[model samples]
Target: MDKEEYKEERFTERCDDKVESIGGDYDLEEEDDSPVEEVRVTISNTDDPSMPCNTFRMWFLGLIFTAIVSFVNQFFYLRQTQISIGYSVVALVSLPMGHFMARVLPTEDFNLLGWKFSLNPGPFSIKEHILIGTMTAVNTSTAYAVDIVILQKLFYHSEKPFIAGLLLVFTTQVTGFALAGALRKFLIRPAHMIWPSTLVTASLFRSLHAGNNAPGDEGRMTRMKYFLLVTLGSFIYYWFPGFIFPTLGVISWICWIDPENVVLSQLTGSNGLGIGTIALDWSAASYYVQPLVTPWFAQVNILIGFILVAWIMVPWAYYTNLWNSKDYPILSPDLFREGGEAYNLTMILTKNVLDEKKYEAYGSVRMDSFFALTYGVGFAGLTATVVHVILYNGKEMLARWRSARLENEDIHSRLMRVYPEVPDWWYISLFVTSITLSLITCIVWDYMPWWAVLLAMVIAIFFVLPVGIVQAVTNQQPGLNIVTEYVIGYMLPGHAIANVTFKTYGYIVNVQALTFTADLKLGHYMKIPPRIMFMAQIISTLISGVINLSTATWLVETRPKVCTKDGYPFTCRNTNTFYSASVIWGAIGPARVFGNVQGAIYSPVQWGFLVGALLPIPFWLLARHFPNVTWLKYVHWPVLLAATSNMPPALPYFYTNGLFIGFVFAFLLRRYRYNWWARYNYLTSAALDTGVAICGLMIFFCIQSWDGEMPAWWGNPSDKNYDHCPLGAANYYGVIS
Candidate 1:
């Protein structure tokens, strides 16, 4: 049987008799692959007797947590160690806070004209907590446009008006949210379109509400107890790797044995490519690919591709001296020249515009071979997603479109049919409002021409559907940033600010759209009214955008050298990487990097798109022609390419760590210990993630931000703190070959 058929069988195998008994009230086949052993669960059953949604308490709690999560997330964004609340910590805390409001506040409802408002209507419903969590999740991370603003200020020494920056952030973020709302009919209403991550959140909600009055919920009670134990254990265990005993996180035995060997350090160190390393830290393991979010099949594809690229390809290319790799750091996002000096971006850039005279004198920009290869892989990954979508999911998408038009009897859609949808006009109004703001912000700041802003919005609108389809189907978002930059670089060369402006609008708009759509689905699953979901998302998003932009501007103005090597916890690693991207794709333009004659040094990487487009055809043919070879089904080329795309920010051990955990939890435990896997797999992920976030937050507030240091000890070695790799440590000083 094919994978889909196998999954269907697994889903129905144990529930045949119960499914027949439940009849129309419950559809076993339509449920998500949930660990909850309930045989008859129905998405269309929205018969709720609980408190009404959109109560005043829901909005109150959402605003409070919005400020809290926004502060924490933006604070961490500038830290050397990148961390965010994401969803787990917020969910963990919000569950109790939501219940507290429900219990403590008065249940009296007051009428204002024809509308009713209440501090508390009754019991704190699960829907209330879901709304709070969804809104909080929206606020936790700085939107993508803030990165562009910070890059311009920190690296290029350029700044925009405060109003312009705020407006840009809001427009880019909400534009996507609006577009996602537009795609709700296509992406959110289907029962079969289950987001695996959403299932974990739903299960957590159930566990939280599993009170003692239930007669036949012993299993749920036990699961709740198990969750508490694991969460406490995880919280305590995290201290070893996160703070006091840092070496435990990066136990590179090979690095310890041969500490000064450049090649060995590069091969085995966590900070380097980490080719043959072991990360004892769960935080490190989940950094690249979250264990709870990614499914086993997806993880398998990533593992195979990582082995081929990080393990085999990178080491060979570096050791063999491809692209003059020996003269530069084995892995970094920084740029250099042929003579092994840090590329003098200042000399080449006059007032943030590339100086042709200085650039020609400085010679061609030299990228570390592997870093360049990632861009190649990224392009290939982008192309592969389009091809893969066309080949694999085309029919599925067509069926969904037909079902959507027919107002099909899919369980989730049927459940949602009761509520009044936030009309299409609402989404259109938001889109139109955001685009006008975007155009005004860009033109006012001279960030980009008015026409470029229009072009960007057009690009964003065009790609959101195709990209949204991939994310809705596969849970992977193939970014448009690279492709968008390629277009702007060629169209409006030598205009760095405009280049970033266009790229942000074109790229981040789609990302926000998908994110908003996901939250809408979460709301749909929990039966939160659609209008309430829209309000909560938009309100929280706008407030968070303002706060994030303000925070970013303050840091840039106050801490001038934030991304420097010595900045430590304030290194602004992501910002520096963003700056590098702006310089490469914006300042230099595609002509200098990819031109056949003018830029022969790096032009070859452009063929990656063609290579990526072609790579998946063979896999599809093999699967088609050899129907019995089930292993062929596992070979998803797009996923493999996407895994390689994680190389820069994620350490080399990331893929390996994902593979290890997938083997233990997803493969072995899921098969042999099915009940245990169902009960604890996602719970463990939540616990570990929350533990790390809590630890990191405490350490940052208590020690790092105050300029207090942990006392020097053997466990916290100065020679090598977290990563044992030191070969490229001096690259920050510009001491090249």
Candidate 2:
């Protein structure tokens, strides 16, 4: 059913006596005496008796999808333009697969020695779908430890045993997962602390499991049929840009028309400011933000910032030669030296230790103006997140904390009470075990001091609640990755391995916690047993660590120059950025780069922190005094900054296409055809994403990529400028002098 019909159904079902007992909505503590209107969200309450969670089918399907999705995640994680199978794809594919197995496999219980089991449990159930989605979700994002592996191999030119790498990945990923479980009372149990993304999955489950003759069954089936049609269309259409016609990925007509003009190419090429650049590649457009999953409200704020920085600011800066932009590429993630060559990291490093004498001679490292500004914008985003949370969500968070202790409950929470809650001790035991394992791995393999591991966990613990609050409310995660790296780098300067070790634990613990908490909220919405959810997540998380590390090792060994300019599709831009971050924050150290005010190219970048910190104050004041200003409510300072933060990993065309499509659906279509938008919007997203990912995966294994040779023709050019831009387009990789 659509959102409006679902709400109407709930309105009829709800009574004043039971209103306060339901789960999805929460009460915010108000400092002002404005009357708060009660808003209610209704979810599917129907349950099928035929399906039992934790059955053989769930376990079987969960493992199968987890392995496949984990491999997909790792493969893309190592690529220049990363892609992954969203949980929606897993949900969409698993439902039919589960039912097909149910029809074919024997349902009769079999006795094996003293055990009784059935290959096909009754009918494939909604709980089984939830289990599969949850397991694969755990593996959907690359394991945090993969970064450590990438840095070692690419930056340090060293390799660790595969076993050690796997162990580290498992330890780091699971430790934070355990912590998220331990804090479930605060993050998960409360009905009002809604994880927004979970709602989409919950809706999908409800629609898939609706009885044949149920009230909205016909509409739900239509939606499903529509989703399939879109999926098929997307799957077939992807072959063009994905393989046969790669120029379709970046249809830079402006560049095509003026291919010989350097200035015009700089303005319109994919590697340049990308004015009027069109991207037909789904992977490029949705790399950072998934259009279907994100609320239009959030998308608008992000797009405003993206347009300002990428379309307007970056071009202006480059043309004006801001921060020596003429000396380097306008859009590159690579660090540079004064002579416009790739920063020769060896000159400033001896045995992974900073060489002060050589560094003084080399002068401070320079950054492409665009790359430096991106960090400055990210810093602004970080500070703005903290400040915005305080001004906007502080009271709501306080109220939630106060109410979490009381006997307050919601409908879903009440339903969940039937199952035995997972014990606190289970998480405690897991945390202790993983922490011990992590410390052992760090000390033995990386020579990181025991104390550094303890310090990292402490950082994770302190930031979990605050960060959790922001994400739970706004659906945006202000990263702790940069802050953690800087903190550890300063304390343990010169020890590159130890700095990275500390940075991984410090940053990833919080990230892992948030990931697990999101899944827990999903379980809560779907009414899956909490204990079962815990098992699925922890098991999948552990498995993902091994799979991800193994994949990274394979790629690094076989494709030695994977992140280099020559690597193209396999260039590992994300990994290269991670390597650069390690070099800047670990090897040379932040103090040396940012402290030398006279020589440092990034000296002005530090002001972003202060500017970001101060920015939220005036907005808050305006919001408080002039509460009637509706536009002020939309001014999310942090989200604006976060939009610019995606520029390096996401091309200028990403935002251009994303904004046009996002606004068309989110604002125009949503306002005019509200019901159609509600019904088919997410359905279209799920179908398109699934189709693109499936086709992309097929193309990788079946064609184009197998021989590592490109068929030279007019269509597929050799200079890497497939769109046929001018010579200036080459600067995107590096403008080496």
Best by TM-score: 2
Candidate 1 on 1-737: residue-level lDDT in tens? 99766443332321111112222343336343332233124233444412356667677888888887787678778865455666766666666677787778887656678554466666677777788889988776687888878877777777777787888899989998888877876777755556555665676776666675556555464654665677678778877776788877777777777767766776777767675577777766776677655778888888878877777777787778777777777777788888667876888878878888888887778877778888888888888878887888879877755755564445555555545678899999998998888888887788889989889888988988767666766676788888789999989877777888899998888788888888887787776777778888999998998888887777667664677766655777777777777777778887887775355477878888999999989988899999999998878878898787756656677667767887888888999998767667776777776666677778767876687676667767665456655653323222433
Candidate 2 lDDT, tens digit per residue, 1-737? 99767544333221101122335533333331111111133354433212367677888899989888888889887776678887878887888888898899887776678655567656787877888999998788888778777777777867777777887888888988888976678777776677666766777777677765656445455766887899899999988777777888887888778676767777788877788888888777776777656678889888788877776777787778777787787777777877677788888878767787888888777767788788888888888888888788889878866765663665566556655678889999999999989888887786478988999999999999878866776677879887888788789776667777788898888998998999898887677777778888888887777788888777777764687878767887777777777777777777766656336667677888888889988988998899999988889888888887766756777777777677778778899988778777877887887788788788877864566544766557766677777444444333333
Backbone N/Cα/C clashes per model: 1, 5
TM of each candidate vs. truth: 0.88, 0.90
Model 2 pairs whose backbones collide: 21-410, 22-410, 22-411, 23-410, 23-411
Estimate the Cα RMSD of every predicted model relative to the unseen true structure. 7.9, 6.7
lDDT of each: 0.73, 0.76
Q: What is the lDDT of candidate 2?
A: 0.76
